[model samples]
Target: MAATDDFSKDNILGEGWTGTVYKGVLPDGSILAVKQLWRSSQSGKGLQAKMETLGRVKYW
Candidate 1:
């Protein structure tokens, strides 16, 4: 099953805070949700904030 097989509009499942999730069909016909992240401009400070958030999650 390849990732490309499941990326069609017809299989969309849901959306969330960050992006829309689509139900993808693998080459073998397995189902999976692929989250598409919305594009945003990230400044240095913003990137640092994200890194801090990730670190916190890792520690938690």
Candidate 2:
């Protein structure tokens, strides 16, 4: 998908080696953090680690 201007620097919430995270407000008035993954790090092992970490999370 194409990123719009609305999700620009002004809407960025944080940034790291992984990617830049943006704060977005949905139509239901819910706020969400959208993490734009780094293309270079989109490997199978990284994805597996992410899944494992998510599975190990006991709470939000």
Candidate 3:
């Protein structure tokens, strides 16, 4: 994705049990963070629900 420049290694911000976090930028020049979730049995709708429940998260 353009946001993460195809998830380039240089853009990696951090990693966690669930996935890796990447630094991203939007076309408007807004900076954001994205998480690339690890593959698991829980995917598609199941994964969507899990993410929705998370709402906004803060991690250092």
Best by lDDT: 3
- Judged by lDDT relative to the true structure, which candidate is superior, 2 or 3? 3
TM-score of each: 0.47, 0.61, 0.68
Best by TM-score: 3
lDDT at 41 for candidate 2?
51
**Any runs in candidate 1 off by more than 4 Å, and if so which?**
1-8, 40-60
Model 1: per-residue Cα lDDT at residue 5:
45
Runs in model 3 lying further than 4 Å from the true structure: 41-54, 57-60
- With a 3 Å backbone cut-off (N, CA, C), the pairs that clash in candidate 1 are 6-24, 6-25
Taking the tens digit of each residue's C-alpha lDDT, what string does model 2 give over 1-60? 123246678878788777777877776766666667777656899877875874665624
Query: Which pairs of residues have clashing backbones in candidate 2?
Result: none
Candidate 1 TM-score, C-alpha based: 0.47
Mark the regions of model 2 whose C-alpha exceeds 4 Å error after superposition.
1-5, 51-60
Using TM-score, rank the candidates from best to worst.
3, 2, 1
What RMSD does each model have against the real structure? 6.4, 4.0, 3.4
C-alpha lDDT score of every prediction, in listed order: 0.60, 0.68, 0.86
Report the lDDT of model 3 for residue 20: 91
Q: After superposition, how far is residue 15 of candidate 3 from its true place, in Å?
A: 0.5
